[model samples]
Target chain A: GFAELLREWESLENEYQNTQETHQLYRQKLEEVSKLQESCVAAITRQRKRLKDMSPSIRKCKQTMTSEEANTMEEIQALIKERPNIFFEMEAFLPKKNGLYLRLVLGNVDITLLSKQSKFAYKDEYETFKLFITVILLLFAFTCQFLVSNRIVDVLFNFLLVWYYATLTIRESILISNGSRIKGWWVFHHYVSAVLSGVMLTWPNGKLYQMFRNQFLAYSFYQNFVHLLQYYYQSGCLYRLRALGERHNMDLTVAGFQSWMWRGLTFLLPFLFFGHFWQLYNGLCLFRMSQLPECTEWQVVMCGSSFLVLFMGNFFTTLTVVYHKFKK
Target chain B: GFAELLREWESLENEYQNTQETHQLYRQKLEEVSKLQESCVAAITRQRKRLKDMSPSIRKCKQTMTSEEANTMEEIQALIKERPNIFFEMEAFLPKKNGLYLRLVLGNVDITLLSKQSKFAYKDEYETFKLFITVILLLFAFTCQFLVSNRIVDVLFNFLLVWYYATLTIRESILISNGSRIKGWWVFHHYVSAVLSGVMLTWPNGKLYQMFRNQFLAYSFYQNFVHLLQYYYQSGCLYRLRALGERHNMDLTVAGFQSWMWRGLTFLLPFLFFGHFWQLYNGLCLFRMSQLPECTEWQVVMCGSSFLVLFMGNFFTTLTVVYHKFKK
Candidate 1:
């Protein structure tokens, strides 16, 4: 019995020692791998910098070159263009500096993507969050339109919008840092939306607010519906295109239209245009209210200007995208 | 001249091709390294699971063994205790699931630390942010006490506190995932603080609010000062201990006392105990206000209970830590 017990004990101890050794070996290998990743990232960054530095000189050299030299220059330009794609796969390992928005909000905290999976997961979360919030906002607007006329309820809704847009802007910036191809205007759009909602939140409960409140809620409902439509349609398009190897996986579904989304989405054009015009109508209504003799709140004029800006940005951007798609 | 031009073009072409090749080679290596990292992490996870599964069996085996076998069992237990340390350094490369708080707030977004530097940087940012916000809160409380008594201002101040605590909780969770050894009660304390601040934010502007506003603001001012003091002293002690190799580098400075912080930090006990008692005092005040005939807001009783909970949790935890340290 003693011999059997000792054998079992020895076996367990042997297993424990073996597991410890294996763990230590893997730990050491992981450390080496981490170091190698760091150096590889550094090398890639340095190479990118060198290519960037040489680009202007190459362009200047092209001006005076023979035809043969021009062909080489063109090849060099093409290579440079394709360079980022070659290294894009390793971006998660690269050292990233915080963009201005992140620096302002989160200080110098590094929000670099650690792996490709985390990046995609974050992007998906962003999409789901946008979709989910759009639904909630639509419902809130519906309630505000029909059920309650309380100023407190309106203020709460406006605060929610402000908070939502603020969070969206921050998340979008992080997505951008992780190589999401979100255009600059969409990010700017979220910032403006946050400011607009914040202004509405501070708008005093008075004649002008009441005059514009119903219209604003109705417009919000319509806008949210359009946003939901765009998200579903655009994400569907992106998914198909990504699957077919025609679109970047990092492409995001934007609030406004883009040229790449034109293949089979013609039926959705009318809704987008109508929403844009509704924004224009809102701007006009607010401008009218701002001129009223009883209008004392600066929020009225501010909101009016913001609406006009949104209308112009959305309408023109959508128009440009459509025109370019037709021309192509 | 033509030959020289050809030569220059060829040299540039060569450089471009060489850069491209180097990039490709490094990219391939990085991919392999990433794969290695994944497998290594998987292995570590598997090993940890195995050890955990074997733990109960080992304990059972210990009770029925001879004295020599018991000594062997003790060795196994000690090895198990030390195994986590061996693998701790590789945690950044490990797959981390979202904690409950992060899951509820941010969905399933991955907040894993990618490297040691980022973890330390994020920890430092958290400390600096806390320090910065504490100063701002202290000033706001001072203004609320002597300079301003407007309900709107008070509401804004309370909202800031709510936002601050909410953010701190999220950041602290991230830090915890990155291997910081912050105790559980501190995180729970922030949750309670966020709730308290939110309840204060929603308390209506009324006679009861007016009665408690000054006292709350005064308590806030003192609490912030004590927080600032604890931050400075605790961080100083942690810094010394960490440098001396006597403390884990990921240790955080908490709002209340910790056992390891007893050396040369006896002076801070009064301030911490005073703050804890002040929470009790606030709880009592709010209870009195809630009992008044004119009081109708649910916020009063809710805030009273929250303050009492916070006081009890803080006082008992600190007392236990102190008692254990002195016994040692």
Candidate 2:
């Protein structure tokens, strides 16, 4: 019995020692990791300096260009292939493992779709296609909403919203992967809008639907109008700028940008703000109503919450961008 | 009459010359733009060379860290505040306009939530709170599903999905804004999922709902189980790695990552694949059936399409990541 007790104590001591050693090993590895992170940050900082030097060009490009284009695509791809290390160097600056993640995802897609010279053209082509499809769909929805806001029309619009946004999300993602400048928040904004549109489409023709139909239609009209303006303004700017020889510089500054386009955006901001505020008010109204005891379905609650989140996110993000731009 | 014709010809000639001059002006601008782009690319190349020199540090960082940590918040904020130029320099390398967008959005949010020393501690604290709340909710849902799979439970779960995903989306966005590398696709993925869950929750307990109940339950179970597994694996890895001092590096390499976690993921992949395939099949099946005259509601078609989209997106993304990692 005494020998057994002594053996058990020795086993416990060995287990503790092993645990201590493992902890020590992990700690050492962590120190190595931190040192590595510092170097990565340093590397990122150096890369950033290079980018800063090109700010004038970048700003010029932004003034002229609307979004990623065929020429820029070629330039970016050429750089990546010829000097993969540049991508690796800049990788330290991006979030988490996304630099590699993007490379891997895009690399696979590029192999399939971007065969050679055609690849750069793909994005431009896609933009053209997207714009064409969007215009057609928007026209269709406007006609339906204006002429006959019936169940079938609502359902049709819902289907279109789902399909269009899904396509937009997919395309936008590809663009981001291909080094386009669309923000995460913008993509997220699209997603929330999609969900709201989908919910609206599915809403049955009831008293609630009747109450909100005009407001909803007006909101859609405003959104589509803004999109049309943005599309044209951006495209025109890009065409002229590209013709002038500016490429890969979309800094969205007042300098070098067409005065007319700036004026148009300035004029449009109030409408956008009004629409955003209306969404906020609608959400508040719905949320208040949903609190009533007579509310049979939780759909009201869910819908209200969705509106709140979407309005808050959209309002905050849009305002922040505007405030910063205006402040500057 | 002859004198009048001569006058018109002279006017036309003047107009033609003016057009030619404008065209020439555009051509000059185009040349300037091209030269700017070239210089920007050259700058980027130089930066890349510098980064290449620090490859060992990059590689080492990649091997050790799981993702961004709480500590880097201060460093990133300070960099953004002090040398915003660095952010701008790095901007050219990122997807367009994100640098400014991120600064505007995060800078606003940071002022509210992140105060001095507490800023770094906030993420960890938030993560802990999220985990605690998630566990409680998951347990409650599990109990409800297991014991009472009724309309109430369905509604409850729907609410939970919406609330959870919305919260998660908001939090992930904040993290992204603060230089976290969570992908845009992932956020979009959750939004689609939330919409799907919401639709399912609202579906009346009828022929379609009855048909889908068991399958939906099983699907939900698997999804929740996988989420639980992922949470533990990710959290455990992050905690241990943090203790070692690594931050903002998540390479997903096998070296420092726990083998069991990899093994678990590998084992789970087939099941996930199977689930994805089943979703596709279910979508096809529903779509085919919905085509029949008896199917009055188009909800069937919408749900089917949603499933198809979700399945394809998830499958392709997952396969791409897995293939890329494993091949390496």
Candidate 3:
């Protein structure tokens, strides 16, 4: 019985929709006829008024209201009464003009888009998906890096870090020549935002932070590593410039070289100083841990390992720069 | 008698200096004349060879070398025997063809210097000096940040980091547009030594590394912070594009908005998720420390204080973004 009632109700809804649509069509036709009748009657009336003042011969011709004219006037009146107002038509739906300013300022997205024929960025949805997947996997690689404990893992990870840093620096140099010199101010701005975001994510009231707090150091380290890579990038670029200049029998670009140096210095100096103090503290921490009977071998290993990696990376990077110059 | 001998020795040294300078000048003149004479001879010889190989009339005339020509030839031979070959005249040290190429490839740098000027970057002198100063200072700051015993200092220093990062990013973006739109690549390539000179600072190794190895986390934070800021910058630009589209009744730009959102998502999501984990770890450390008997008041206060600053700053930034979004 319930099924029958539901079916009946659905049928009723369909019937109602059909009836409403038919009624609307009828009303629209009626409105159109009424409007036509009204316009005809108004025209005839205006002619009758003019007929009152016109000469008799002219009046006998155009002034005489024929039955056809009377019929047309009646049709106009009927149409006017049945139809909707002209102004009420979907006039608001039409596009408005914000004038020439918008046209000048904005690019036509349709023109610029990477559709079937056009090639621009953000096209190839498949590629985006693949890129995103790769990025996710990379993030996972970062995760495994911190979570695991082994000498091979440690060595491999730091090596990877160096590689990543070197590649990024190289990329940046390429960009610098290409005119994508990321300046000091921009880096500073992004740094502030990232720190703030980290804090926000970790806020006590937030669930995200509730699951992740102590990892701040590690996470921050990874982040800073990327940043350092960027720094080296600009530096390495300048390095190439010097080398290329020599090859071409040109004097080194003294001024441009210096500017890159300044920007790079600002980034490196603070980080190096921070790392220096950390080394001292880390050494002290390891020493203090030694006195504690509860200290585990793993704790000592972590301390010893991080310190070694940190120092080695910094030392070799500096030495590389010097050695490169000497080699040159 | 010893004083008299010393005076005589000094007089001999002065006389020697004068004689040496005179000899050097004479040698330079002889070298110049000889080189010039050789080039002239080569040019004349080549011309004579070509003429001799050509119609006999020209060859016969060449055989009867003029008295003036013979005189020039004799003078050139004498000087060539006495002097060394120099490529171009010293006044224009660079060969004319190569100099013109360098001038066209790069702006005039001989007259323009790396100094306080309208240079795209800090001039060369300031660059090296600034880089040296900042790197040392940055190493200091990085080290200090790790101490984590002063809340106010951490916040203040982070703020400074933010400012620098911002400057860097802005410069980078401008470089991109400049490089592509105008022939600014030439300027950058010429001035910056093809963008390589600005990146890695070569230095004596151990000192720089030993100084910077300690405070890895702080440096890492600064780096991550910059990436987050990039996320915001990309998003903000897209948001404005959306606004313009809506205002101008152009629905096509909605695609642009989608792509921008996609970009920001890729940019920030990693940091956000990674940061989420760190925040939790920090909390655990903070909480555990609070319960520990060995925790110093300074350590507790500074750590707690750093958290508060980060939290507040993040909250305000979120609020700023939200408020602007909904406000008329």
- Candidate 3 displacement at residue B263 in angstroms: 22
lDDT of model 2 at position A5: 30
Error of 1 at B93 (Å): 5.1
Ranking by lDDT: 1, 2, 3
Predicted structure with the largest lDDT when compared to the true one = 1
**Candidate 1 vs candidate 3: which has greater DockQ?**
1
Candidate order, TM-score descending: 1, 2, 3
**DockQ for candidate 2, C-alpha atoms:** 0.02
Query: Evaluated with DockQ, which candidate comes out highest?
Result: 1
Report the CAPRI category for model 2: incorrect
- Candidate 1 per-residue C-alpha lDDT over A236-266 given as tens digits, one digit per residue, 9 for 90 to 100: 7756654554445333453133444564468
For model 3, the superposed segments whose C-alpha errors exceed 4 Å read: A1-245, A248-328, B1-240, B243-292, B296-300, B320-327
Question: CA lDDT of B137 in candidate 3?
Answer: 44
Write the residue-wise lDDT of candidate 3 on A1-328 in tens digits: 3233335435534643453444344335434433443443343344334333332322244344567654644554454333223211111111122223222111110011101111112122212333343354355456544575432333233323332332233222222222232443332332333333322211222222222223433544544564445445544554555455521223455556545655665666566656545544554555565566654333243443455445445545555554654453
Model 1 lDDT tens row, B131-168:
99999999999998999888668867876886688677
Chain B TM-scores, listed for every candidate in order, come to 0.84, 0.58, 0.28
In candidate 1, stretches whose alpha carbon ends up further than 4 angstroms from where it belongs are A1-93, A103-121, A136-163, A192-220, A248-260, A277-328, B1-67, B78-93, B103-110, B114-118, B139-163, B195-217, B246-260, B283-309
Compute fnat per model: 0.06, 0.00, 0.00
Among the candidates, what TM-score does chain A have in each?
0.82, 0.59, 0.29
Which candidate, 2 or 3, would have the higher DockQ against the true structure? Answer: 2
